[model samples]
Target: MDKKTENFLGIDVGGTHVKIGLVDTKGQILQFAKEITASLRENPLGFNLAFVEVVGKYLAKFPEVQHVGIGLPGLVSKDRTTTLEIPAISELNGFDLKSALLEKYPNTIFHLENDASAAAVGELHFGTGQTSQDYLFITLGTGIGSALILDGEVFKGVRGNAMEMGHMLSRGNSRLEPLIGRNGILKIAARMMDTFPEEVGQLAGQELGMHVLVGAASAGNSIALKTFAEVGEILGEAIVSTVRILDVNEIYFGGGISAALPYIMPSLDKTVHQYLSPYYLSDIKMQRATLENDAGTLGAAALCFMD
Candidate 1:
C-alpha cells in the first residue's frame, strides 16, 4: 500500500492493558488488538523492554504502517520524548520511550503524548460536529483526566503536561479525583445508602459500582440520585475554577463515568451557574463527547496529524 494512503497505528497504554488500533485519516479504526500489561510484569526483560518488544511485534505484523502514535496515561516530558511519571506502570518512569522505540523501529515515525491530551486531539479530528478550536476535554474514569484544546491544538501549559484536574483541590481540601473518581463515587453511593436506608431501593445492600449506581439512578432510586448529585456538585465546582482560569466556554466530558451525565447534569449545571457570572454562563456549552470508549485509541492515532 502507498505510504500516503497507509493506516496509522495507535497505541493507548493503560495500567492494565495496551489497546492497539489501525486507524485511518477519518479516525475509523480499521483493526484492533490488545495486550495485557499484567502478564508482562514479571517478564525477564523487564516491563519497559517487554513493552517495546510488543510494539515491535505489532510493527512487524502490520508492515504497511509507517506512523505510530502512543497515548500514555501519565506525565510525559515537555518535549514529548520520554515518559516522565506513569504511575500505573512505574517501570516506564523516567524511561526514554521515544528514543527506545525509534532505535528499534528506525523506519517508523512516532508521536508520544499524554493520554488526556491525545483524546482531545482525537476529538478535534473525530468528534461529531465538534469543530470548535477551543474547548476543555475531561475524562472521568479511574481518575479525572483533562486537556485543553486551543486554536485547534492541545495546549501544553509551559510544562507540556498542562491540564491535571485530578489534583485540583476541592471541597474539604481533598483532591478532585478521590472525591468523584470510581472509588469515590462508590463511596458516595455507600454513604447515601447508609444515610437513606429506606430510600436506597436498588442500591441497598448491593455491591457498589458505577454500573449499579447508574442503573439505580435510571430506576429512580433516591440514594443513587443523591449520590450523583453530590458528585455533580463537586465536579461542577472544579469546572467553574478551571473555566475561570482558562476562559473556555466549550467543554466535553468523556470516559466511563460520563455515562451518568444525565443524572449529574442537574447539580452540575446548578453549581456552574451559581458560581460563574452572566458572561461566563451565557455561552457555555457543555456536553458529553461522541467518542466514549474509543477516545483513547483514536486519540492516540490522531496524534499523527499534529506537528
Candidate 2:
C-alpha cells in the first residue's frame, strides 16, 4: 500500500463566498476553488448542513488529507467549538460548527479560528518578512479586523475575541472601522473633494470608490492625497493607544484598502510618533502583510499548523 502523504484542507468562510484550498505542509496550495455562500444557504438542508456536506466532497477528492482548517469572519467560542454573533451569516450565529464537522468526519481532526487571527497565523507561518514573535495585525477593508500575535502564537484575550481595534472608539466617539474602513474612506474622499473643489482632478466626475481614490492618489490628486492623510491620522491614533496597551512594536496592514498604505503612511507614522513615548516608538515597524489576496485561503490553511 502507498504511504499516505500528509496534506491539509483549508476553508475560508467569508460574508458572500467561501474559499477552499488544498494545502501542503509548507503552506503551498495545491488546488483551489470558490463557492458562493448564498447558494449554500439556499440548500434545502440548511446552511450548516450544506457546508458540512460540501467538505465531504473535498475530502473524498483528497483522500490522504486528515486535517481540515476553517477560518470564520467573527467571534468564536474560546474552546473553538462554536461561532458566535456572526454578523454576516445569522444562521451560523452560536452554531456548534466544530461538533457538526466532527460528527460528519469522525476520523478527521478540525481546526477553526477567526479570519483575522488565522491571517496572523498565516503570516507567522508563511509571510515574507522579518516575522516577529510579537506584533499587531490590522486588516483595513470593508470592516477593520485585528489580531495580536505574542510569542508566535495568537493572543486570545479573556474571551477569544481580544483585539477588535476596529470597534474601538476614536474621533467623535466613533468606532475606528466606521471612520477608516472602505466606506468610511470613500466618505472621507467625498468630504475632501467637496471641501477642496480645486484639488479634485480625475476623481471629480467619477464614482468615488476606493479604486478611484487609489488611482487618483497614485496620479498625485491633491484631494485623494488629503483623504488618505486623514485616514492615516485616524488609524495612527488608534495604533498609538493599542501600542500603549499591547506594547508591541511591529504592525502589519492587510486588506484591499491597505494597497494605499503609502498614502496613509506619512500621517500614520507621524501620529504614532506624536503620541507614543520614545520607548514605544523606539523600533516601531509598520508594513504591508505579504500574503496579499491569498491571505484568507492561506490563513485558513495555516490553522492546521496551529497544532
Candidate 3:
C-alpha cells in the first residue's frame, strides 16, 4: 500500500509580492516564502509560471503538497478561469488564471478565489466564524475589499459579486475607494498637505499615506491625525451603511491599512454610532482584526473545502 501524503498549499498573489505556504488540513501554515509579485505585472502570463518556480524552490522537499489554492484580489468567474477587472491589481485582469494554474501544477488540484473572499473563508473557518453567524471581514490595504459572512458561509447575493462595500459612495461624492481606500487616504493626505503647507510642511517633503499619517498622528501631528480621523469617518459611514441594513452581529477589520486602526478607531466609532440605530449598536459589535496577515493564506486553503 502507498502512504497517503497529506498536505495543502496556499498562495496569496498581491500587487507587490506573492506569499506561498505549505500548510496543514487544520488550517495551520507550516512553511512559507515570498517573491516579488511585480514579475506578473511586467509579464502578465508569468503569474503562474513564477508561482510554479517559487513552489518548486521552497516546497521541493515537501511532495505532500498535492493540493493548492490561490487568492487573487479580483472577482473570479464561476469557472475560476477569469479575474474580472479591478482597480488595484490591474495586472491580473483578463488572465486565464484557472488554465494557467492547471498547466503549471498538473498533479495538484488548484482552487482560486477573490482575496477578500479567501480572507472571509479563513475567518469563517479558523478565525471568528466559529463564534458568530453573521459578520463582515474588511481588508483595509492599498484598496479595501470585503467578504460578507451570513450563517457561516460567504454570502454571494444571487450573483457571485456581493459585499463590495469598499466601492460604496460614502464621501466627497466620489466612489468609496477615492476617499476611504489607501489611495483615498493618500488623496486626503495630499489635499491636507496642499491645504496647510505649513502644518504639514514636513509631510510636504515627501509623499503622504497611511504610514506617514500614522507616524505623524503618533507624534501628535494634528494634520495627519485629522486625516486618519477623516478616513475613519468615511470608512465607518460606508461600513455602517451596509451593516445597518444587514444587521450583522459583528464586523472585523483586517488588511495592511488596519494596522492603523488605533489611529482611526475614534472617528470610525463616532461615525458608526451616528448612523447606527440604538437597537443595532446595542446588538452589533465592531472590532479590529486579530488574525493579521495569515487570514489570506488560511482563507485560500478553505477553497479546498468551500466553493
Candidate 4:
C-alpha cells in the first residue's frame, strides 16, 4: 500500500471513554467514534480482552486500516507491550495489550504510548503553532501530565517513563499535580476566596469548579485571577527545574485548564524568568496548544506516524 494513501486508526483511552479516529496520512480524521469505558468493563472476557475486541470492532468497520495506535493515560513498559500503574483502568495494569492485539489481528500493526507523549507527537504533526523538533509538552487538566519531544521523537528515559512531571516535588514538598491539578486548583480558589471574602461576587454561593473559575477570571474577577496566578507560580517553579534539566527552548501547554492560561501567564512567566538564567531564556516559547479538544484523538492518530 502506498504510504500517502494508507489510512490508520488511532485510539485514545480514557477512564470514561475511548476515542477512535480513522485518519489519513495527512493527519485528517476521516471518521471518529467513541467507546464507553464502563461498557467495556461489563464484558465477561475482562477489560483487557474487551479493549482488544475494540480494535476488531473498528477494523470490521474500516477494513482498509492496517495500522492502529493507542494513547494510554498512564505508564507503559519500556518495550511498549504492557501497561503499568494505570490509575483509572486498574484492569489494564500489567496487561500485555500488544500481544492481545496481535493475537486478535495478526496482520495489523499497533503502536502504544503515554497519552501526553501522543499529544506531543500530535502537536509535532498537526499543531497550528508548529512546535520545534525539541520541546517540552505539558497537559494541565485533572492531573499534570508531561512528555519530552527531543529530536522529533518521544524521549523515553532509561525505563520508558522519563517525564513524570506531575510526580515532581513543589512547595511544601507536595507533588506538582496535587498542587496544580483540577482539585488542587479548586482548593487554592477556596483558600483565596476565604482569605478575601469581599472579592467573592458571583462565586459567593456557587459550587466551585473549573468552569466557574475560568468564567470568573474572564469577567475580571480578582479572586479568580489571583487563584490562577498562584497556580501559575507553583507550576512555573516546577518548569524552571524541568527546563534546566531538559534544556529545551520551547514549551506547549494543552488540556482543559489551559483555557485559563492567559490568567496564569503573568505569574508563570515571572516565576520562570526569575529563576532561569539568560542562556536558558534566550529563545523560550510558552503558549497554549492549538489542537484543543481534538488533541487526544488526533494525538492517537499521530502515533501511527511516529515510526
lDDT of 4 by residue, 1-307 (tens): 6657898898999999999999887878899999999999898988999998888999999999988889999999988889997999999999999998999899988899999999999999889887789989999999999999999999998999999999999999999999999999999999999999999988989999999999999999999999999998999999999998889879999999999999999999999999999999998899999888888989998888877
lDDT of 4 at 8: 83
Q: For residues 39-77, could you state the per-residue lDDT of candidate 1 as single tens digits?
A: 776789998999999999999999988889899989999
- Where model 4 places Cα greater than 4 Å from the true spot, the runs are none
Candidate 3 residue-wise lDDT at 121 = 73
Q: In model 4, what lDDT does residue 149 have?
A: 97
* lDDT for each candidate structure: 0.91, 0.90, 0.75, 0.92
Error of 1 at 139 (Å): 0.4
- Estimate the TM-score of every prediction: 0.97, 0.97, 0.83, 0.98
Residue 127, candidate 2: alpha-carbon lDDT: 87
lDDT, candidate 2, 1-307, per-residue tens:
1113477888999989989999877778899998889999999998889999999989999988888889999989998999997888888999999999999899998999999999888888778877878989999999999999998888999988899999999999999999999999999988987899988978767978888899999999999999999999999999999999999999999888889999999999999989999988887899999988888888888888776
| Model 1 weakest lDDT span, ten residues long | 1-10
* Per-residue error (Å), model 1, residue 265: 0.9
Candidate 2 residue pairs in backbone clash: none
RMSD of each: 1.4, 1.9, 3.7, 1.0
Instruction: State the lDDT at 93 in candidate 1.
Output: 94
Question: lDDT of model 3 at residue 64?
Answer: 67
Candidate 1 whole-model C-alpha lDDT, 0 to 1: 0.91
What would you estimate as the lDDT of candidate 3? 0.75
User: After best superposition, candidate 4 residue 247: deviation in angstroms?
Assistant: 0.7
